[model samples]
Target: MQMTVSEVLARFVSETDFSALNNDNVVAAKTTISDCIGCTVAGSATEVGRIVRRVAQSSGGEGKATIIGGVSGASAQAAALVNGAAAHALDYDDILWSLYGHPSVTVLSATLAVAETEGASGRDLIQAYAIGVEIIGKLGRAVNPQHYEHGWHATASIGVIGAAAACAKLMRLTEKQIAMALGIAASQASGVRRNFGTMTKPLHAGNAARAGVFSAELARDGFTSSLVAFEGEFGWARTLNARTVPDSDGLQVMLGKPWELTEPGIVLKRYPSCGGTHCALDAMIAIKDQHNLKLEEIERIDCDASPFAHKVLLYPRPVSGLEGKFSMEFCLAVAAIEGSAALRHFDEAWINDPRVQALLPRISFNPRADLEPAISADAVPAEVTVFARGQAFSQKVLVPSGDPRNPMSTADRRAKFMDCADGILETDVAEKLFNDWERLDQVAQLDELLSPLRPQN
Candidate 1:
């Protein structure tokens, strides 16, 4: 019997077993949740986040869910959008570089909000997260490499599917219900590369998270959609991207084996810009510190990277903060000038500063097969160089900082949370969340953790 997307999604949720946790999936689960908390804390006070919260509140979405960055309450849909954006606002959150370019942010944000609303236990929250990471991350591989190449935001598109699955699981829907949830979510999936460098970019994440929860909620109440939504002639695969599709047994492959969250793994980013440009950022920063190259002595800079990365990051002369995140050349230029790039470097003033703007004209990048390392199907290695005092110095980085292979230390991760929490949560509140995250299973109420998510400033 053919199923609907929601049906399969509901089934995936019903099948999840918390106690049988795979060791690798558990770690990925922790890291991803840790990553989302850090990003949300950092983005709580941003202009974009505040406005969106107001908009959601104005919509009269009264419910039990605590909006991560909201002062009071909102419907599940409202919380998902706000928290989802916060999870990736700084771009320093952990990554799934080999998969959806970005994940966990949208997946976990929705799960967290819904979990809180459902009055779910910590163990249950953890289980929902695992199912989400699996379904979404695997779907990334399914429509992958090309899904992104087709200009679809995998984090938003593929992520919606996972978010719905996670919500369904948390709600304990039947297999038939999951298929319907997935089907509804499939139709709701959407995002475009064109929105990069704008507030809409992060909004994609928030919207998808919200959409996933809504899809699952509707499914649980007898709503239905097409389960084979992905395999049809004009379905997700055909209409969104026909260039490449997962094998015929795509869904069957690894349904409960070789978890995608563990195998391909996740990337933890060191910088706050686009993950696409981080390899180049790492290479540039390394070469600068290594050779002690001062910007005043530099004449020009050049870089090489994956064509897809270059396509998204082609904004050499970025005009806004959002554009800055997508501009490899611009980000590297600023890093060279400031000696390092961090959360503050993404401010509009820095992005539009005359020096950064002037330097933009001197940098360029193109496709380079030599930069490839096969980190996975989508590894993006980068090479960056600066011409200074008539001498050329350059460096190459195969991957960015946050990959599971080159994971950030616990201290580094904590520090990241603090950095993002600045001006948002009280110091004590931030500290408490990190210390208590692992023990979330022990707590019956999520309010204590969620209460501090609102901006303290």
Candidate 2:
């Protein structure tokens, strides 16, 4: 008999070991993990992060896992919820094109929570995270574009399964238990694109992470679920994904073939806005620097983006910071006026700035089907035309900075970490934490490694 999709993934989770990872895989894992930690720490200072931590502390009771920036720790599930939300709150986490979502927030959050509870080594955490990302990326290949176009938020909908697999791996669950966990996670899978600019957006990631830990833990203790949950007539792929079903055999063959981390790779975000705005932001910033053009000198800025970018960049004139993250107009305007779109530029103050208001109406973002055929499948192309000083200057960017093809340097990554940690942690403490996390594979105990995440009196 042929194996089901869940069973195949469970077996992959069961069999893949740390030794199978190459140097590149380890480096990617470490980089993504450390970057996510920075984002989480930064996000923990946000309103949503504060709210979730309070809720988790009230309901979760005291447990083993550390909640970054929380006054106290919570259960693994609760900590995953808090950390996952924080990781995505700023929209600063890494992105995987294959998954069409922020992969690290879900996978790393659940893995870290479970790893701490299980007293697992850093190598174990890295192995689990890589395996989870691989599973998510392959599944994405099978159902995405269709799945995403159907209004599902892939980060939460797909991430739940990846998080379950990673948590199951960390907990050393058997293949059967892993399949059961995936089935349980499938039932919990849900997130919609309509909630893009709200607090519910980050909550999607948190909920997925929480559900993943809950599912894996339940399966380990004899929980039962259908092994064929992903392919059953009333199952995840069939029900959630319209007109598309995953090819289990093909996906199994492709798993870890070249490792998604090394091939297509993760895109570490340089700016703290929606990924859709990134290409345009890159182009606009470059044009600003090259021409030394003042904001007032520009008459109009036109950006032609992919269908995907047009769909996700929902806000035109945002009224709040969260909404600003999804506004291509706001991002480009700030990038032009400020010369860069940093995390600080997405606040309400910036959103309501008179200069920003004046520039907002001058920027236009539209979907162009023509750009789709010109670039690779993974490329996010943005053609920016700036009409300035009665002259038109144009720049088109296929791949923005921080992509594997055009990677960020070690210093740049460290600088991002420091920037994220600026207000939340003292400089010395943040520096030490970044240094320690860089050596993640060598850490024996997660507790020791995460000690600095808790705020000191």
Model 2 collision count: 0
Q: For each candidate in the order shown, give its overall lDDT on alpha carbons.
A: 0.76, 0.90
Residue pairs with clashing backbones, model 2 = none
Off by over 4 Å in 2: 373-377
Instruction: Output the TM-score of candidate 1.
Output: 0.93
Best-performing candidate as measured by TM-score: 2
Candidate 1, run of 10 with poorest lDDT? 2-11
What is the Å distance of residue 178 in model 1 from its true position? Answer: 1.2
Candidate 1 lDDT (Cα, whole model)? 0.76
Question: Candidate 1: where are CA atoms >4 Å away?
Answer: 1-10, 242-248, 372-378, 455-457
What TM-score do all the candidates reach, one by one?
Answer: 0.93, 0.98
Q: Model 1: per-residue lDDT, tens digit, 1-457?
A: 6543334445556866886577667767776687678787677678777777778888886888876667556788888988888676666666675455677877888898889888897778878877887777666666666777778888898888889888887777788877888888889989997887778878889999999999889988999876568776678777778345544355554665666666677777778888888778888888888888887888999888866576677577777776788888878888899777788888779977888877888888878877654434545778887899888897878767777666788888778777877777678877888877756666677777776665456
